[model samples]
Target: MLALVLQELQKSKEPLSVAALSKKLNIDQSALEGMLDHWVRKKRLIENNAQGEMPANCAACSGHARSCHCSAQCPFIARMPKTYSIAAGERGTDND
Candidate 1:
């Protein structure tokens, strides 16, 4: 599954939303999120946080991303769901 995820990201011409990846893998969004995190830790993928792109409603975010509750209703959050891509140095490498 990790390999498949890496392959998809490698082949994508642009960043992909978590929802799209979830559908492609036919996996629950939450579960896929966990798996993506694992790949991130392994340095096989890069997670796009979309910083400084916060919505106006994120004023109450408190700057604690992991614990922030505003994400659910934040427009920017909806537009960028922790997008992933192949690591820069590993780009186009078959070893990913």
Candidate 2:
């Protein structure tokens, strides 16, 4: 199941929110969050907090990288959700 989560992130070109991912994978949101955190600790995934500038690949961004002017508090940007993406340049990870 953990591997599945990684695979989905790898497949996506854009970062995905836990809620959207859990719905796609049919897993409970809380369970999905635990899996995401595990990958983050392993450095296989990067958690995008969405509390500051948004990444270009993030679902919230309108295709603009780093130049986002989002507020520090994400709640103000209702569409911006906490998201995750594959860690850049991570290699040889045993995605068990």
* Candidate 2 accuracy as lDDT: 0.74
Could you give candidate 2's per-residue lDDT for residues 4-85 as a string of tens digits? 9998888776788999899989999988989999999999998775433555334445444455565454444445467888
Residue lDDT tens for model 1, 1-96: 878888888878766668989888788988888888898899988776544445422434523453555677655543334577777776765452
How far in Å is the alpha carbon of 16 misplaced in model 1? 1.4
Task: Give the runs in model 2 whose Cα sits over 4 Å from its true position.
Answer: 50-79, 91-96
Task: Estimate the overall C-alpha local distance difference test score of candidate 1.
Answer: 0.69
Q: Which pairs clash (backbone N, Cα, C closer than 3 Å) in model 1?
A: none
- In candidate 2, position 61 carries an lDDT of 51
Please list the C-alpha lDDT of all candidates, in the order they appear.
Answer: 0.69, 0.74
Clashes of 2: 0
The parts of candidate 1 lying over 4 Å away from their true place are 50-79, 93-96
| Best model number under lDDT | 2
